[model samples]
Target chain A: MVPLYWYLWLGSVVFAVGIFGFLTRRNIIIMFLSIELMLNGVNISLVALSHYMQDLRGQILVFFVIAVAAAEAAIGLAIIIAMFRNKATLHADEIAEMKG
Target chain B: MVEWFFGYLAGAVILLSILVVLSRNPVHSVLWMLLMFLHVAGLYLLLNAEFLAATQVIVYAGAILVLFLFVVMLLNLKEELRIKRFTGGWPFRLLIAAGILIILKKVLDGFKVGFKGPWSIEAIEQATHTKALGKVLFTEYILPFEIASLILLVAIIGAVFLAKKRLRT
Candidate 1:
């Protein structure tokens, strides 16, 4: 059986990559994808822990996390669409001004 | 065999995740994210979370990445593609990434196993993962489930409203 630490390591690497993307990427959609990446990383660790601990609670927590991730993605994409409509640019830097 | 499976899945997940971050085109990044999600589902299956694996495939790879692709297509980013886009200061991003990695490693290194519950693999195999999940989610976690549904409703309304045409602005 694979130990929990390995899974935890996998999750953390994914999270770190996501953080890097979130920080360095100028494209807003990519930034959103990075956020999803981080969420998935957390989901991995949670599920692994739940399995190793022989508990259902952590899996249940992952259920809620997936739900929240879905909600976040839907709303985030909608916001991206709206911002694109208003500003005609997807560059986070250029869209810095609140004004259209 | 299980170790090999986990190793491959972990490798693919990490590689695709890095690709999603490093790819120049947003569309490519979305596609890479799709592949990464699939690998993550495989990892979930390795953890005996078949239901979660299925959900990961269906919801994350199927629904969310498609939505990402849709938005990327809607944007028509030809000009955006021409310029290789990145925020200022390479070192800051590297610092942030390294910092997060170190923090996660430290936290997991010090991690303690908490109280084990009744949901052992044999118990879950008898009851089945999905059924057991549903039972607990519907009974003990009913309140949070309802809240999740409400949150989805809000998200639906918010998405529709935000993406809607102004009509008479």
Candidate 2:
């Protein structure tokens, strides 16, 4: 059997990549995708811990996390659309009109 | 054998995720993200979370990705393509990346492993993942489940309100 630490290590690597992408990428959409990646990393660890502990709660929490992620994507994309309409730009740096 | 399979799946997930971040075209990023989600769902299946795997595919790969693509297309694609894909300040990004690595190292160093609970492998196999999940989710987590529904409803309303085109006065 694969040890639990391997999964946790994988999760941490993926989460680090997500953070890197989120901080470095200029496109707002890519940044949002990075956020999703970070969430997936968390989900992986949650499921791994669930399996390791032989508990159902972690998996249940994963379910809730997925639900919340969906909700977040919906609202976030809508907000992105609204921003695009107003600013006509996708670059995060250029969208700082309110940065007085 | 299963360990090798897990290794390959995990590696593919990390690779596709990097591609999702690095791809220049927004459309390509969305596609890469779709593949990454599928791989993640596969990992969930390996972990014996069958229902979560199915939901991951349906909700993330199917619905959320399509939504991303729609918004990608709706935006000014030509303009988006003309701009630089990455931001300036590599030193700062590198600093943050190093900080994250340090944090991960610290967390993993002290990580504990293996605590048995009610749902052992044999018990879960006998009861089946979906059934086992449903029992606990409906009973122990029913309140949070209902709250999740409320949150989804709010999200729907918020999306509609935010995306609707305003009328001229």
Candidate 3:
């Protein structure tokens, strides 16, 4: 009914902001959030494109993306916790040493 | 009027997403991320992807984000949190973002793709995007899907191994 371009435009803006967040934030959790934002942005675009193209493929991809995102979240948060237990800091800059 | 509603919803979601990125408090950020997910789910509904909208809500808002919040609170990181800026300066960051926006505009402008009209909700109500998607995924994309699941299993085990010092003998 309304213009599809609007969704795409919004998606792109959100995605860009997410990119900026991912690049800028020094905190690992915040960076993880930026990643989530980026993923959400991509999902928005995928769903929008699927709707416009009358294709189901994009939606399917979103499904896979969500699954991967879940697995990523689990592994990432676990790693963050493990790191925090030893370093007592979550900031990316402070925890430079990966091995200890 | 409806278009205006959708526009506002989209804007709110984007704003919430920005808050998620900018908030210093991880708890707040996770909440904002949840709202963003909900807003995207609404967008999916608008796009006639009902099943996707539902799955998006259930998977992201209900599960993944909750896991994030749990981790944030479990660590009780508020005490040792660092209030650090993203980059050198906000103004400089904004300027760089603007430059990036301009470049993106230039890159995407030349690409001309024709738009097909929107699909009616009623037309898709019969078969449902979920059913159709399931059929396609199982029929055509079954192998990749299974592989992805296996990868996730491996990741799950790897996470356990990584987090725990040692496995039971």
Which candidate's DockQ is highest? Answer: 1
User: What is the C-alpha lDDT profile of model 3 across B1-169, one tens digit per residue?
Assistant: 7697798789898789889878878888889888888888888888888888889889889999998988888886765455665766656766676677677667656655456533334545666666777877899789989988997998799788767865459
Better of 2 and 3 by lDDT: 2
In model 3, what is chain B's TM-score? 0.82
How does model 1 do on interface RMSD, in angstroms?
0.9
Rank candidates by lDDT, best first.
1, 2, 3
Candidate 2, residues B51-156, lDDT tens digits: the string is 8999999999999999999999888779778777777786699689769978887989898875689999999999988999999999999999999999999999
Q: Give each prediction's root-mean-square deviation over alpha carbons.
A: 1.5, 1.2, 2.8
After superposition, candidate 3 runs with Cα above 4 Å error:
A98-100, B89-93, B114-123, B166-169
**C-alpha displacement of B98 in model 1, angstroms?**
0.4
Indicate the DockQ of the complex predicted as candidate 3. Answer: 0.57
The runs of at least 3 residues in candidate 1 whose Cα sits more than 4 Å from the true structure, single-residue gaps closed, are none
Q: Relative to the true interface, what fraction of contacts does candidate 2 keep?
A: 0.83
| Residue-level lDDT tens digits of model 1 in B29-133 | 999999898898888888899999999999988998898898899888988887766777967888979998998899889998888999999999999899999
lDDT of 3 at A45: 79
**What's the true lDDT of residue B102 in model 2?**
81
Per-residue error (Å), model 2, residue B15: 1.0
